[model samples]
Target: MSGKPKLHYFNGRGRMEPIRWLLAAAGVEFEESYLEKKEDLTKLQKDGSLLFQQVPMVEIDGMKLVQTRAIANYIATKIDMYVEGMFDLNELLMMYVIQPADKKEEYFANMMDKAENRYFPAFEKVLKDHGKDFLVGNQLSRADVQLLEVILMAEEYNPSILAKFPLLQSFKARISNIPTIKKFLQPGSQRKPRTTEEDVARAMKIFRS
Candidate 1:
């Protein structure tokens, strides 16, 4: 993996999952360093030289990149994974879901409201109108994976949340089926998903008010 770029993320699935799958699907080797606990966090802070205050940072030949979307886009661009207008369309999709009630504090307060029935239809509509096989054409792209992350997160609140969207399910299956991605699905490569669920619950407890 030293020969290729490296990606740093907490052991939980979180936002990094889709981007990691994107790089793997490209058949490109990358360093998938899983961080957990206070020490792991401190060590990453020490050695990571973070370009952004985010996990899923990619270091290509020692250059660091941050932001889940940016990381996805960078890998997508390197492998030409983006579709026509998909780049912009995907951004629009993200904004539609997050729907910052307060642009200044969007990331902090936005997710609390998402547990309701507000945005799922928007996503389903986009996936349905765009077709099920992918968000764009036949090949998988960053948009597909990002949507997968959203779907997975939504599952925390309701497993049936995305059941209506067959294409999105197909897209999730497609990424999970990849050889490299499949490997990460095994129990040991990363932290157990149940732990991530716990983290989500703890975060939501604060927003539950």
Candidate 2:
């Protein structure tokens, strides 16, 4: 790797927050490069700097890694925070729910069924069986950090949404209490997710294309 890793993304959290959380949890120093306008993206795409014409790119080891999940996975692996051989049910469910609006109705219906009948129960079982504070093993992993963001966003919509999932609520509380993560929550440490319905609608329109 270079002297320090570099991340490129928009000023908004978008897909970069999870990568930020992973870096913070690992106690790694890094640099951020934020794009300000559509022209910035276009310019990057015109060159080969942006492979997919997207932000959330990470520059490390003289290479640029594209895609949010891929970059997060790479960082998690570098810091040894990734849980090997484990598929995160919550993450899978989230991917399904947050897909493009064209098929969102169908995907959301499937997500609800999986969440109620399979995903949540499996997560609860893992917690009860392992008696651990985190989702995977005893220690916090990228999965936990990623899940915390999701839970936080959900709570924005309904404050008591997690009440039905006591184990998940407890897990979220535990992770939020971590010193690094607690510091991350302080005002201005990070950008808040774009929450307005119009902002979300516009974002979805771009995403669907």
**Candidate of highest TM-score:** 2
Which ten-residue region of model 2 has the weakest summed lDDT? Answer: 78-87
**lDDT of all predictions:** 0.57, 0.66
| Least accurate 10 contiguous residues by lDDT in model 1 | 84-93
Tell me, by lDDT, which candidate is best: 2
Off by over 4 Å in 2: 78-118, 197-209
Cand. 1 TM to true fold: 0.58
lDDT of 1: 0.57
Model 1 lDDT at residue 112 = 30
Candidate 2 residue 96 Cα shift, in angstroms, is 12
In order of listing, the candidates' clash counts read 0, 0
The sequence of per-residue lDDT tens digits that candidate 2 reaches over residues 94-118 is 3543567798778766645554555
For each candidate in turn, the TM-score is 0.58, 0.73
